[model samples]
Target: MHTLPGARDTRRAARRVQVRIGGVVQGVGFRPFIYGLARQHGLSGYVLNDGDGVLAEIEGASLDGFLAALRAAPPPLARIERVDVRDIPPDGGKGFEIRETIHRPGHTRMATDAPPCPSCLQELFDPAGRFYLYPFISCTQCGPRLTITRALPFDRANTTMSAFSLCPDCRRDYQAPGNRRFHAETIACASCGPRLSASTDQIASALCDGAIVALKGVGGFHLYCDAGNEAAVRRLRVRKNRPAKPFATLVADLAAAGLVAIVDPLSRRMLERPERPIVLLARRTIVAPSVAPGLRQIGVMLPSAPIHHLLFHALAQEARRRGTSAPACLVATSANRAGMPLITDNGAAHAQLAGLADLIVTHDRDIENGLDDSVMTVIDRAPACLRRARGIVPAPIDLAEDGPPVLAVGAYLKATICIIRGREAFLSQHIGDLDSPQAIRRHADAIRRMTAFLGVVPLVVACDLHPDYPSSRYAQESGMPVLPVQHHLAHLAAVAAERIVRGPYLGLALDGHGHGHDGGNWGGELLHVDGSTWHRLGHLAPVPLPGGDRAAREPWRMGVAVLATLGRGDEAGRRFHTVPQAARLAGLVAGGAFPGTSSMGRLFDAAAALLGICVRQSHEAEAAMALEALATAPRGLVNGYRLNGGTLDFLPLLAALSQPGMDARTGADLFHGTVIAGLSALTASHAARLGVRTVLLAGGCLANRLLADGLAGALRNAGLNPIMPRSVPANDGGLSLGQAAWARLCLKDGTRAGIPGYERT
Candidate 1:
């Protein structure tokens, strides 16, 4: 190489600039670290904090070196979502400097507070360390963020922790730029920080003995069990009344998880993701079949909380010392019933978890909000949320344009409500099904708390159009101006929110039940959705829903309803002994329930029941799940649906049941094929009518793999694109967002301006 200029010569020509950072940047000491790194690289710059995140500017011979150091070694606990770098005319600065924090709004994006940091973790276990066994050992790097945040510009004064004053030692560390605790937001000692006082050793003893324990964790309470203990798991089931659904498990770490489950690269990344959601992983053969009974995958998550890490670390140590093996896994299920909010109050925990848990390990900190463990799956290395809760939610989804402050009540089951003001949409944690009074109350409280935290007063309310839904009823009771959106339209709105591309796309909404705009039960529907207006272009015929809600519980009723719709005798209905004879007091449903419905879900249920795969459904979507499981192993089944009005005719399939040779399993598969055929036909019709060839599938029924994937594949074969929900759930959890979008459009149109109390009245 030629005698090029030395590296030092290049530095002489470099320029230096000063920058200030804000947002969750303070308690994290991002300034001092930036100063140290700049000095190491012979750079000159200044770093400071305001109310938002950290800000910094650098000048050096190697500009790339400065940028690399900034990104390469970010604080362990400080999660930087965005880094705003702007070029300023350089000053003849000599050296890098770290400066004190300044108060500034809109200067930086505030990051959500993370859990305890590694230094804190080390101190926690060190007997001679200052914070030995301290439950709230936090450095500048970690501890409560949004949970304590009162408002942004995320300074201590704007957080709930503002109530607590700092001690002398802690104050000194916070002021010392060289110390890791410098500018630490929630830094506290054993005497000054949050405390842990146990009432008894009963809970810890129970946990050691492999008993189900209900614990108040960082975000919310969790019902935990040793995954290896079948007896403990069965006990949890009997106590919680959660029988069939697979529970999510918390493994020690990525390595331990890889041992039990087949974690692919994508799934492994999800396990390590900052959100720390339960990753659905395909299981290895080493686990018990009962671990996820009949499931193709198991949900796994890493311990995100410092306390959880400590507990598992101790357990692992004990196992290593004892020279015996113990299950390094624990089921971390929600501490609530199927449709209720998580029990946060200690008294409520004692009452609700007493039966489900042998002992309860709870803390004194009041959980202002009940956030569930976020559940996600990594698809194509992109995060896909199954249940958006802790580490998320209450975290607003930005809008293209702000709306009138509004509270949107989601659909009835798997419900998650959303409250929006400005660019923030504070979505409540998984609020289970909205059928129960307890769930409704929790939904209301979550709404109030989230709205209060965001400092927004909702001027309007949006709700699902299902008039009888408990969520709808609660919206009506609020006495706020209510905007009732059709369930399918809400589904379309949700898709539109994510896509936000263009308007008036054809939306395929396939679900079990939704109140139609024309006052009928609608599930399978095709609609034209623009910015605001939604026109029902085509829908599954309205079928009779005999016994209404009862039909959902017993899918055999759907089969009977379909049979009668096709002119089959009522005598055939008596074959379903699962339904009491009293159900038939209404006689044969001559023209199907509700005249007709193209509901893809009910069609699935009917087919499932007809195939004898699921004659009686004990839980929500039991029939659909069963049908999909059967499809997993095809038993030489062919198509069996009729086409009427260029639509899927479920009646002909029901007529196939009258065939002397067909059995229920065959009947079910035939139904599956039939529904696929109908959906394909429906897609073609909509594409032709709307001149749009793209189909967006939205609904709980779409969660069924057989229908969603099969229909999507079929559509693609017909030269169409089928877009299923990849971000939000296909279920009601997504309905609130959709409802809010539709309401925004309606308010823009002034469609229901004079119709006050329209939903309630």
Candidate 2:
């Protein structure tokens, strides 16, 4: 190997370099790792964290070698995005040391909370260990981060644990350079940490007695009950105002989880991973029916906090005393009213969950940011995040190009905010639907906190085209230049952003509803997206949405409208005889009193209703999911669609569904197959016409495994490459990223072009 003159000079001279390391370097023991690395290389300097990132000044003979090693290997949980090194005059420093964190507002990236590592778990169970029976046991590698952090420069004083000072023994561990707990800000023994009182014991007893217990965890309080207790689960459902939405289960271990749900290798890994998110898996027969209600899949997760483990430990001991297996599972659902923010404070938990929980178990440690457990599921053997929060949030997404500061306020449902600083887009944790006052407040708070922490004032604000959306309203009131992005266009832009494919690509967006540029409701759409501009090439035929939004909640109403659209309005009365409003809805559709929608989601609802799979929806996407579940096998039938000039009609499919002797499952399978065939043909024709090979699939409807997997396979078989979101969600939760990407592209192009509200911005 030949070395350049500059490289040779760098290797030979003793010099000092200022290194700034960015990306997830604040909370995961990065300082300790840096300290160890510097000492190992015989370098003398100090490492400190600031709002921007980790900054270090090292003076050593082998500066180049040190920099190489630092970039190659970091701490187990550290994510190094960029490392900037600059040469400077050598400072006469003797020993490597960890210095106090520098407080710089708006430049630091917050770290996500992590599950307890194996070492910490073992120590938690060891009777002789100093942290035995401690509910808040954590080390440098694990524990709460974003949920407990109030500000940047993540030190103890800036965390919720500041009030609980370290004891003498813990102080020794913190000061010891060689100890793993050295400089671990959250480190504390049972003697000095947040104390666990008799309330936990009472909560455990309540669980054993089939009573709901609201117990505080790392993020927020969770209402828990025995999963096997049907009455208890039902009582909780009635009390919490949740009738049918499935509750997530917290299992003691992998074995316990397997007993309730089918754990494939991939799902098992996700369940045991450090993030410890709730993984939706196929249900077995062990769990009570009421736990998940009408769903065949159950959401299961292992304990993410030491307090949860301690509660399970108490239950296991009691089970051992009785000579039986441990109580392996608990129905752990967020302790909040329907459509409200998660309960974070003890007083709020008690007040809000009064009738729902039989006992309340809490600690003194404050929850700075109330976060719910993240939910994920495997779709086509790939992990898809349903809700991003807790263990999976505050981690920035890297964009292909850096742009000016911008804020993207997400959709009305699954609301989240994205703050773009340079090339990094930091998405806030899930803020949920912006319908309620509390949810809207949470949306505002998240924006304020994220902007204040990141130190970026957005030059441009992006939001949905729907003027009624709370997120859009927030942006309009933000006083910044506002850009209203079409909902489906934003979905396409999000996929492009994640894949870094800036292009004129074919996009298929399928969802329930989005405001179309033509003032119509759009869902199933095909478009040509280039940068910030998109042209609608084709779409599903519009059908009346009987009673408007009411049809979304009642699939039977949509089915009647489908019948009316097919000129078989007489069949609606007999086919939907059980639903009293069927005749009225049919009449309304005939009278043209309802708005028309081209939403693939309403199409799914109609199919489910016509097949009697789901007549009404209790939660979002319930009918669509039930319809997908009924599709047990591929029917290989694809003759039920008509593709005309830029219009794909499914009236033929509705006719087939209304056949007298059609099997419900076969109809569902055929519906899915026909949709796949229709969409693939549509995308292929358009892609060929436009000379594009890549097809992007997005929208909430893509969350359906059958549709996502089937369409991708079909598109590929048709000689077109298909792209979908992997890192971000495909639903409204991911709309913020797309909005931001589109805004950035528009600003880069220097033309208002196709973006809405561009002049206002």
Candidate 3:
């Protein structure tokens, strides 16, 4: 630190400094924040948007101090990526002033969407506020940004909300330099902006009667029902045909939230984080069992939007007036059918949700793009996003190094694409599973719009090695240079990115399915990746998948496939005797009826089917979920399946499948026990073979607590540390980061020998 010469300078001499701030500053009210900071610092200068970030010139008595304050303190929603400053000649004496936005051609940088701001929420409840009760009330600090905007410059005219005209009061607030709403493009009042309408007063009265009303919220309409209403919750479950997947909830405040869910110091802080993501917290016994069903925790969030705030505020006030001890809690799940895009169009909501919803709450501001609320949990004392959406999307992921601009079409399920422009990696919002035509179209549209907005022209395109993936196919058709990334490697790369690891480590990539490098379907794998070079070190034994993809739908086929692969051995042959689907599936497998794949997820489904837990899957992971639900305690001996060099030998495991007298339930229990044993043995073998003591466990299969917990314990007992994603999901949703990391390594020297399994195919 350099100290200025000690001199009595009565007249303050102005000095100017050119500054550049990056990261999530764009579209996040960075310009307004800069303006406020400048005025406060008594600095005279103008701030404007740039291609990669925000740029400003501050001339003041203490330029260095002013720059530091600007970076140290930013609006709640704005995140400073990086701030650079350099001394510049003073621009003469003048008062501090904010300048109009300047458009730089070919500069298309936009920030991600953000949660609703606090001031907007306050005005919603303040009867005299301009936007009292306005569902779409927003300011420079909050409201829709990335999702609703159609183009760059992130102005109202370029957003879906452009349909609504601002009222006089809103215009006044927008033009006021000192107001928080100053230049808030999305600012609007109820009179000339979006309106709130409900089908019946039943809901309106519920809002007034201290009941938690599930209003359709931004990002997507949420299915809101009172949280404490066990019957209402049950009704919601029944109506949505969702039996067990946990639903997110919004509480009146942090105190009220703590009453229903276990809130620790860390969880409490996360609830108050500006992102307003739903935090999965331990459950309180006072809450209804039907809310989460079988799970030990419940997801909770504080009201982020003005409309939500008002509802909770009113509910709390009514509870106070009535002297009731209970506080209102609301279940807020995406308002869409399971495995589909969230409902955003008002007309579509009316047409599709008429039967499911008893009352419908809506607004006039069109949701140009739909996003789901982000879900998170703490892993290793860091906030990890389970489902990154809403406030998180559109914020570019900082790439490790600059590479050829490319588009990485992520895995089929949990489909989200990534665009690499310079050092920024922009992952698209959650696009849902790409099984349906609607989902596929959404994926394409998202790619087009995002690319246009970011103004990045890809020089290369990437896709999963799985040739059958719809996303991969789309990538192939784009007429851009395409690079195929192996599915499991993608998983490893993702873990590496999250850990920011540069060296080789044990990587266990487990998922349902991905096209293997050898043209086989692979799900469970182990690899050692470093700086763009990945080498397969070990993997789970492959199991025959009877009827191929059909077996995934009906898990019983999987059990039969495993039995067939194990050969008609005593335990294996005997275990298939009692299953009804056994005879048919066994016959199919014996006759070489279906394609086979090595997948861990399929194995779980098969185990579930063998246990007679879930014969048919109404949703992806249904059988695996049911299997996890059946686990009572860890009670099994470790067993070893064969490992040929690095590839797992499935022959032994298959010998127990499709036996002469095995019952589904007995087979399931045995399968579960055997898998536990095998995993333990495998971990011990790896520790002995590699002399490495730590392993990273990733992929969608880890979502199965039974598998994750068992595998982790097995690894730990072998004196090895097991790492799992706590901040990022261990699924395809987080695949892009891994893909980007892998690409970074691969593009380094143009070597393709690392993932050698796919070289021939």
Candidate 4:
């Protein structure tokens, strides 16, 4: 033992302490790391894994050094959320060691799947190494965790890895404390682990010949094709029934990604996240035109699995062998039909993707949870999440305060669930819309899996106000007490929860659609929220929506409705003669038989239709996205809006776009600028009236970076604090988070039945 400076005997200075660490410390080599750390500090103790997290004891004269090292350095993949130390008498043990995992009743966080670490990549390329060119190379540092996990106490017995018995070489590596794979649940080699059904060379050859391949990944199957081949991309689009929706491109590395998209510092940071989310960046000229049609930005990502590197390596070798250039990137997209959940089953992939994929490249490993790739963008110079899945899900978001467990089932579109336990909220991966039966089943399965893994039995269940939504119905059927929250209020609460706002704050919700508390249709709204109570302050002026929901899909319906509302009913038939329903829609609008919506999304659609930008949409937000991309020079018409007590009207702006010979680019620019100007002024006025200084901006329409950034800047200029959603999405993907926040407050206030003004089904 090392001698202390003041004591001649080392025994006098020796102190033993037990440390309890929580959060993301299981199945990540935490115990092995602690053992190594203790030995380095001349401490004699043992580290063990429990249901709660990692527990360790150290006895040494250099106790301070040992504790400092624990706080300063931990395993790269481990996330130490909290540490609790208790002093104990010296054990006088001889050597440090790792103990067996023990079961306990407590909470533990799940780490999302990560890409291969640098060290693994090095061994993958070295010819002399045993794992050279191995497609399933993994270690404690990086690999599948949440995807392969079945239940908590994340042991090999509870994971998909239990199927493969360790061979001699792998057993040695797993037992050796010095090896990187020591105590790794996913320890394996090519000899005994999962094997690919097809060779890398064959996959590369098929891609080179313009064939779309359905390749299995850690989360789900991905249908990938060569991005440089127009015929291939177009065929994939046609076969997949995705005509104009952009497909994300998977590049070999940062250098190849740079060739296709401009990677700013903000974009690079998100791109480099361990989970490797698909980041939208400025597009260059390296991909096929059809890959991202009519869009100025493109979604780009690096390889997330080992097979991708092996495939790209083969492609590079082929370029040298054939004296030809390889494709810049691969068009990697989720392997699912339109409006369906991602396919994870091998048999299901083979059955469903038969027509879409020319070949299927699969492995034997089972995917316990099917997670789609997460998508991210930059808003206000910060990471704005579009979809939370794969590398982003199953990870807990730290809440501002501790509360009883609550399960929040999200709204209809972009469904997700949140399970709150103590000061942490575990938001599920992006589960597509709850429109289809299969999607609802997926959502239910996700909730079951997440709650089961986290061991959370909620005291109350929360859902959207709309009674008919599948999620709302599910909450009603859940047996637990139901707490219904208003749509827009939940949106505001979500932003506030993320920002941890302390008091009453105003919120601006620029959304596409949400069921209002008054049974009216609302989208563009301003709300004031405080704890368990909230009030609707103001909103955008209402406009007639012909055909109700159908008007969103067919912008021409909105266009004709606007024309009829403007007292030019006869012009609709003449202007949109090509659209068969235009005349009938105009008739309906004239008769005032249609309902009205204060949706900024409908306004965007109306502007697009008037400018002749897009008559019909191929996907959600297609028209709005196209319109935003076309705008170049923005010159908003002066005094083009009207502000009544609480309503901001844009009829004059729509009337301007409805004029004949209005250029699409000029019309788009004017519409965006005017909306920003009008919203800023209205929000500022409300803030002054309410004496509130903080403003929370949320809802789907805020997905528009131009509008989000513009409104944020304007709000700041008005001497107000604007809080935007950072950890969660601004769309319905984040609705459950807000619902969770509000539900927590409602539970605290003894409003378990439901919040005031929100009707319970």
> lDDT: which candidate is best?
4
Task: For each candidate in turn, give its C-alpha RMSD to the true structure in angstroms.
Answer: 5.5, 2.9, 4.8, 2.4
**Clash count (model 1, backbone only):** 27
Q: Write the per-residue lDDT of candidate 4 for residues 631-748, one digit (tens) a residue.
A: 7655568987898979999999999999998888888889988898899889999899989999999999887888888889889999999999987989999999999988988777
For model 1, residues 37-154, the per-residue Cα lDDT tens digits are: 7766777777766544676778877555656556666776454545656667877677767565566544244455455566777888899977776666777666766555555555
Worst 10 residues of 3 by lDDT: 1-10
Task: Pick the TM-score winner.
Answer: 4
Estimate the TM-score of every prediction.
Answer: 0.82, 0.95, 0.86, 0.97
Rank order by lDDT, top first? 4, 2, 3, 1
Whole-model Cα lDDT per candidate? 0.68, 0.85, 0.71, 0.87
As for TM-score, the candidate ahead, 1 or 4, is 4
Residue 467 accuracy (lDDT) in model 3: 79
Better of 2 and 3 by TM-score: 2
Q: What would the TM-score be for candidate 4 when compared with the true structure?
A: 0.97
